[model samples]
Target: MSLLVEMRGIEKRFPGVHALRSVRFDLKPGEVHALMGENGAGKSTLMKILSGNYQRDGGEIFFEGKPVAPDSPRAATDLGIGIIHQELSLMNDLTAAQNVFIGREPRKSFGRLDEPALNRQTADIFSSMNLKLDPKAQVDTLTIAKQQMVEIAKALSYKSRVLIMDEPTAALNDAEIAELFVIIRKLRSEGVGIIYISHKMDEIKRIADRVTVMRDGEYVDTVDAESTPLSRIISMMVGREVSEKPLDVPDTRGNEVALEVRNLKRGREIRDVSFTVRRGEILGFAGLMGAGRTEVARAVFGADPRDDGEILVHGKPVSIHSPSDAVRSGIGYLSEDRKRFGLATGMNVRANIALASLDRFTSKAGVLDERGMRETANNYIDQLGIRTPSDTQEVRLLSGGNQQKVVVAKWLLRDCDILFFDEPTRGIDVGAKSEIYKLLEELAAQGRAIIVISSELPEVMRLSHRIAVMCEGRLTGILPGGAETTQEQIMELATQRESAMAPVGEVA
Candidate 1:
C-alpha cells in the first residue's frame, strides 16, 4: 500500500484560538486510518481543511504523491475525495435518488432531469452495497440508519478514491453497523483509502488498521490499532489517563416519588409503558436504537401527543397537552438532536441560556430584564464551565460539549424539578463528559428527578440510580443500580419483545 494523502505541519487559526497546530496526518491506500480525539481536539478541523471547507494557515497537502490544493468542495470531489459529515445533510423533501445526485444530476437531450436514468443509477449503487432502499422514496421517510446508508451511498457514487466518514455509527444499530463494515471492507479490497473519525473505542479496535491520536489541536501519536490498548489510546487523546469507573450518584431508595407514568402509549413506538422516578435520582432509560427510549421521553415531556397515559407530579395528576404544559408543571426536556430541537444555533449563549425561563426575566409591564438575564447567563457560564469567550458568543461557535452545557443551563434556570436528558453526552469529549456527569450528580443531590435516555449501555449502567429497560415501546423491567447489573443484563431486557401491558405471568 502507498500513501494516498498526507498533511505535514498543518496549522489553522481563528479570531481568538488556534484550532489546529502542527498537525500531521497520513492515509494509505486500502487501509482504514482512525482519527481518535475528544471533542474540540481538532479532529473535525483537520478534516475540514482536507475537504476544502476551511483553509489552513500553513500546511502541505499531498495527494497521490503530488502536492495539491482544493479550494472548494467541488474541487475536492473532483479529486476523488468525498466526506460524509457527522450530521445528515440530505434535504428531507427530496427523493433518495435526488439527494444522492443532487448537484451532479444526469441531464437529458433537452437539459431536463433524466428521472428514470437517475433512479436506475441510484438503484444500481444500492444494489452494489446490498442496501435495500427505494430510489424514489422520500428521504424524510427513511430511518436514521437508512439515512446514514444514503450518505454512504452518495459518497461512493462519486467513485471516491479516498473517503472520510465522521461518526458514521452515531445513529446506527448493531445490525446496521455490521452492514456498513461489510461495505467498508468491500471498498478497502478495491484499494480505497478510508479515514474514520469517531469517539467509539470498540469500533476503532474492530475496524481500523492504524490509529492516530490528536489532543489540544496537535497530533499526539499514531500506532497499530491491534497492538494499542484502549486505555493507552484514550490517554493519548485526552493527554491524561482516564478512569473507567461509572459516575457516582447518591442512592435514592428511600426517596419519595417525583414523577410517575402509567399506561403510556404513543404511535407504534411506545406501548403501555410505566415507570416511576424518585426525588434526587437519576433514572436511566436503556435500549437499542429504535427501542422507544427517546419516544417515551418525548411523550412525557409533551413534545409528542400520547394516546393514553397518566402522568403524576408528586403523586398529583397533571394534564400535559404540549411542551408548555410540561414546562409549567416543572418538567424540562433536552432533545437528542441538539441542533434540531434543543438550541437556536444562531443565537448567542446568553440568549439561549434564558430561553426556557424568559418569563422570569420579564417585569409586570412585560418589559424584558436584560441585565438580570445577562447576570443569570454569566453565572451559568461560570458554574457549568462553558468554554465560550463570552456570554455574547453565538451558540454555534462553541464546541459540542459547551453547547450541551448551554442546554443544561437553560433547564436549570427554569427551576425544572423533573428533567429529561436525551443523549446528554452524545458528541462530548472525555473531559466534558466527566464534568456533565458531575453536574448531573449534583443536580440529583439537590433533590431533582432526572431521567436519562441513552443508547450507550455503559453510560446507562454508570450514572443511573435505577435502570429501566425499554424494547419496542414496552418497559421490560427495572434493575437496581450498581455493580450487580451488567451490560448484557440490560441488553436482554432491551431486546425483550413481550408486551409490558400483559399480566406479569402471561408475558414472555
Candidate 2:
C-alpha cells in the first residue's frame, strides 16, 4: 500500500508558545488513522499545517511520495486535501449548495452565479455519498448531524482523497454517529484516506485502523487499534498511569435540600421538569442529545426563561429572571459550550475569575482592586493546579482542560453553594478528566449541591450520588448511582417519553 500523505519534522511556533515540536505522521490510502492527544498537545496544529490552514515553520510534506508545499487552504484543497474543523464553518444563512461552493461557485454568462448548476452539482455530490440532504435547504434549519453531512459533501465535491475530521462527533448523538460511521466506511472502501481526530476512546476503537498518540506537541507513538488496549493509548498520550477509584456513594437522605425545582417548563425544548439537589450531594442529569438536560439547568440558572416553574433555594421561592438573580441566590452554571457561554477567552484568568463577583471586589470610591484580583486568581490557580504561566495569562491560550478549570474557579470565587456543571469534562483529556472528577467530589464533600449534566453514562454513574434521567424535556426517572447502576437502566429512562413518564418523587 502506498502512502497517501506524509509529514516529517513538523514545527510550529507562536509569539511565546512552542505549539509543536518535531512531529511526524503518515497516512495510507484507504485507511482511517486516528489522532489522539490532550488539548494543546498540538494535534490540531499539526493538522492545520497539513491542510494548509497554517504554514509550518519547518517541515516537509509529501503527497503520493512527491514533495509538496501547500501554503494556503485553497492550495491544499486543489491538491485533494479537505479538513472539517471542530467548529463548523458553514454560512448558516445561505443554502446548503451555496455553502458547499462558497468561493468557487459555477458561473454563467457574464460571470453571474449559476444557481441551478451549483445546486445540481451539489445534489450530484450528495447522491454519490448516499446522503439525503436537500441542496436548496437553508443551513440554519438543518440539524448538527445534517450540517456535518454537508461538510463531508463539500469535501467530496473537491474530489478529495484525504479527509481530515476534527472532533467530528462532539455535537452529534448516537444515531447520528452511527450514520457518520457508515459514510466513513463507504469512503474507506472507495480508497479515501481519513485522518480522524477525537478524544473519545470508544469512537477510535470502533472506526480507526491505526492510532497515533501525541503529547505536548510531540509524536509519542503509533499503535495498531485492534492490538492496543485503551489504557496503554491513554498512558502514552499523558505519559502517566492514570487510575480511577470507584465513586463512594454516600447516604444523603439526611442532608439538607439546597435547591429544588417544581414543574419547570419552556416550550417543547423543556417540559414540566422537577428535581431536587441536596447539600453535600452530586445529582447527575442523564439523557440523550436534545433530551433537555442542559435546558433544565439553563432554566433553573435563569440563562433561559421558563414559562411556569418554581425555583426554591433552601425552601424559599426565588425570583430569578436573569443570571444576575440566580448568582445573587447562590447558583453557578458551567455551560457545556464553555468557550461561548462560560469564559471570556480573550481575557486573562484573573479578570474571568472575578467576573461573576466583580461588585464584591470594587471599593466604595468605584476603584477596582487589582491586587486583590491577582491574589484571588493565584489562590485558585494553585488550589486547582491550573497549568499557566501566571494568573494574567489569557484563558484562550490555555488548553481545554485548563480553560475549564478557569471556569470552575470563576464559580468558586462567587461562593455559590449550588453549582451545575453541564458536560463538565467534554473535550478534556483523561488525565484532566480524573482531576475534574476529584474536584467535583471535593466540592460535594464541602457541602455544595452539584448538578452534573452529561451524555456519557459512565461519567454520570461515576460522579453522581443519584442519577436523574430525562426524555423529550421531561423527567422520566431518578435512580441511585454507583456500581449497582447499569447503563441499560439509564437508557431505558432516557428514551421513556412523557406517556411513559412517572411523576417526580414517584419513581421507586
Candidate 3:
C-alpha cells in the first residue's frame, strides 16, 4: 500500500535557528505514529511544514505516492490534512460551535451564518466523541481541558485523511484522555493516519503503533512502540540514558527562614496553614487534587483574598494585599496555567521576559531601552536554553516547554528572594524537565527560597530538600526529603485530616 504521508530530508531554517535538518518521517494508512522529542527538537516545525503553516526550506513530501507542495494551511486542509496545534487557538468571544467551524462555518441564503446548522453539526461531533460539552458554551468560559477538546473536535470536523495532534492530551485529565484514545482507535480503524506528538511516554505506549524520536533538529530513529523500552526512546530524544536517582538533599536545618506563614486562613479552602520555607532550600508542596496546595500559593501570593494570615519575609512581617505587593516584597509566582496567567502569548519573547522587571530596563525619563532589553532577554534565552529563532519571536510561536522556560526567566530576571513554582513541569518533556529541576536547585543554591508544588511524587522526592504535604486545605505533615522519604509516606500525609496532624515536625 502507498504511504499516507512521507517527508524526506526535511530542512527548515529561521533567521538564527536551523529548526529541522534532514528530518524524515512517514505515516501509515491506519497506525498511530508518536513523535517524541524535547523542547526545540523541531517536531512542531516539521509538522507545521506538513500542515502548510510554514514553507519548508528544503524537503520532499509525498502524499499517497504523489509529490505535492502544500503552500498554506487552507491548501493542506484541501488535501485532507488537519492539525490540532500544541497551543490552544480559539476565538475567545465565539461560541464553541462557532470556533469549531470558524472560517468555513455554514452559511444561509443571505450569506448569514447558519447558527442552528453549526450548533447541530458541532453537537453531533461532540456526541460521537463521547464528549458531553454544550456546543453553545462560550469559548472563554470553558475550562482549559474543555477548550482543548474543542480543538480536537474542530480537527475531527475536517474529516481529514491525515490528523496531526500536538500535545492533545496536555490539558486533558485521565478520563478525557481515555475518551480521546477511544476516538483515536476508531479513526485508526477507519484507515485514517494519526500523527501524535507528546512528551508523555506512557501515552505513547498505550496508543501508538510506532514511535519516532527527534533530538535537536534531527531524526534519531523510529521503532515499535510496545516492543521498545521507554528508557531507550528517552535516551534517543535526550542524547543520553536518563536514569531515576534519589534526591540528595543538603542539610538546611541552620538556614534562616526566608518566608513564614502563620495561621494562614482563607475560609475553608486554607485552614490555619502554617509553614516556613528557608533560604537555600527547595520546599516541595505535595497534595492530591482539591487539597489546597495551589490555594495556599494563591492566598500567599495575594491573588486570592485571605480571610486572615500573617506573612513574614526575612523574619519581618510584610503586608501583601495584591500580586503587585507580593512582587514588591521580592516574591515571584509561576502559575500552573501558564497560558492564562504566566505569559502574554501574543507578545515577543524579549517583551515578556522584561515584563516583570520593566523598571530595570527603562530610564528615569521613561525612555524604554530597546537594545538593553534585547540584550538581557538574549542572555536569559541562552542561559535558560529557551528555544527561539530570536528574542523578537512571538511567545505563542514557541513550544509549550519553551514558553514555560520564558515564564521562569521572567521571575529569574526579577531576582526575587522567594519563588513559587506551581506544577512547574506539567506538560513538559523529560529533557526540559531536567533543566527546570536543575534551575530550581541552582536558584536555591543562590539563597533563593523556593516552593515547588507538584502532584508527581517522584518529582517532589527528586527536587525537594523538605516536603510539605497538604490534605483538605490544611498542612497535614512535613517530612524530611531524600531517598529515605518514600511516596507511601507522602501519600499518607496527603490524605490525612487536619485534626490528625502529626507532631513529629514543627510547621512554624
Which model scores highest in lDDT?
A: 2
Q: Residues 1-508, candidate 1, lDDT per residue (tens digit)?
A: 5699999999999988999999999999999999988888999989988988988899899999999888888888888899999999999999999999998899999899999999999999999888889999999999888898898889889998999999998888788888889988888888999999887788998899999999889999999999989889988877778885655556676789899899999878998888889899999888887889898999988988999999999999999989999998999998989988999999999999999888899899999998998999999999989988899999998888899989999988988989999998887767677778888888898999999988888888888888888777788878777676899888778777774333321111
lDDT of 3 by residue, 322-438 (tens): 999999888999999998899999999999999999999889999999999999999999998898889999998787778988998998888788999999998788987887888
Highest-TM-score candidate? 2
C-alpha displacement of 32 in model 3, angstroms?
A: 1.3
Q: Which model, 1 or 2, shows the larger lDDT? A: 2
List, residue by residue over 36-94, the lDDT tens digit for candidate 2: 98888999999999898899999899999999999999999999999999889999999
lDDT of 2: 0.92
Arrange candidates, best lDDT first: 2, 3, 1
The TM-score measured for candidate 3 stands at 0.88
Q: How much is 287 displaced in model 2, in angstroms?
A: 1.3
Stretches off by above 4 angstroms in model 3 are 107-115, 267-269, 337-354, 368-409, 492-508
